[model samples]
Target: MRKHLAFAGFATALLMLAPPAVASADKPEPRVSGSMSGTLPKEFGPWAGEPVKFTIDAHGRPAGVKGTFKVFHDRIDGSKPVGDFEGKITCLAVAGEVAVATGVITKGYVNILDKPTEDVTGKKVSFTVHDNGRDDRIFWIWEFMGAPVNDCQGTAPAFKPARGDFTIRG
Candidate 1:
């Protein structure tokens, strides 16, 4: 029958040029933690007991930093806490560093007056620290006054910390 209809038209043109099979869908990776407090700029008194804990991965940059600062005796009568710090944080961002922090005060500051002793360390001092993710809101910049200010600022929810931390990582 004409070579079996040309072999069924070449097997229906090789099943219409074959090629059709796909199944793929998987994408989800981005996590961040939170928790922060501010107020601790008496010129860092002198390491104010050794306060400087940081950790930002996910891409933020900074990866890890320990803690410990001390330097009392500068109470102009503000009461206390002239220099109190804390620590704790994790990282995971690569290439230069993106942003990823866990928790624990990033930067601190306290000196409104009414009893604000007077530890302007060196000068430049601002507060408003706290950022969990998506742009929490941070803005601390304790420069000169004590030297070694860590800056921070966000938008979503809140993440602010820029007044003194010395930021340093690799």
Candidate 2:
């Protein structure tokens, strides 16, 4: 009888030590998508486009980025979308010199900085999204005339960058 009792106790202890299983629903999906209307700075001459509309699509999970993104830049002539492309955001996070959050974006890593002048509700932040494979398609938000402009990327001078007014929904 004592041996049987010991065995039962061991069994109960084992069960209690076991880790609880979590359902798939418990995990939240990782996705960042939004749009913004901002300026596209002209790197060289004194030419900056007015605030324009641009969209973003980033989807993935915690610590893992397996999503895509699309960018559309309007021409100064009010003609076609001179800047545009659909690519994958292999990594996603908000981390860098500022230390906001770290994640991989469309092609490379990005450093996101929140704007103090604007409230967090408007999602005012800075972005420096670059590509790991190439440094040509990098985008960043920097202080332009006191305010931050969200368009600039290239070899000589980075052009057009919209503001970071995208809201996190998902």
Candidate 3:
């Protein structure tokens, strides 16, 4: 029918004249990535002698990632296993070369603790990366401790790693 053809042509022309869909500027830019493996200083808590390792590659925000984050710990002297935990990266706020991330511990285990799964799992955790290259420092690792710990809602103290290298990008 001529009427149908005319309507199709008009719709096509209107669509062609419409403005293109632009990317949203409100969305967060790709940022925040860190990987490190070393021993936490004795100042943290009892698990100072253990070797800990973790990796965080958070790009966007809460809704983007499913697993959130992961942390690994191993016993080097063949004694007992170190503490390990994981959860989703709920929040990541970056400033300059330092980035602070927060999430909940869904599951974990620590040799020192009697019940790491029940103690650490379901609790909140935070990690700070001061990406200064070989001299880079870890601001805080709030998950390993028990109660009365710093949440790192804003900033946490920076402690130099005793060993291992760090590759943090912000």
* Best candidate (score: lDDT): 3
Candidate number that wins on TM-score, 1 or 2: 2
Compare the candidates by TM-score and give the number of the best one.
3
Model 1 ranges with Cα > 4 A deviation: 1-78, 91-101, 105-167
Give the count of colliding residue pairs in each prediction.
52, 18, 2
Q: What CA RMSD would you report for each candidate?
A: 16.9, 15.7, 12.6
User: What lDDT does the true structure give each of the candidates?
Assistant: 0.35, 0.40, 0.64
Which runs of model 3 end up more than 4 angstroms from their true locations?
1-30, 42-45, 61-67, 113-119, 141-144, 148-157, 162-170
Q: Which stretches of candidate 2 lie over 4 Å from their true place?
A: 1-29, 41-47, 94-165
- lDDT per residue for candidate 2 within 46-114, as digits (tens), equals 236633454556655445655444545455666444333344444444322111112222222112233
Which residue pairs in candidate 3 collide? 68-88, 68-89
What is residue 127's positional error in candidate 2, in angstroms? 4.9
Over 1-170, each residue of candidate 3 has an lDDT whose tens digit, in order, gives 99999999999999999999864677455356656667766775766666777776665533453225677777657665666677767776667777777777777755665644434777777777777767877654554564433433645536676555544333
| Per-residue lDDT of 164 in model 3 | 51
User: Which candidate, 2 or 3, has the higher TM-score?
Assistant: 3
lDDT of 1 by residue, 17-119 (tens): 9877543224223333333333335554442333332233222334333222222222444455444433333332211212323233334444432545443
Q: Return the TM-score for candidate 3, rounded to 2 decimals.
A: 0.63
Ranking by lDDT: 3, 2, 1
State residue 19's C-alpha deviation in candidate 2, in Å: 15
Regarding TM-score, does 1 or 3 come out ahead? 3
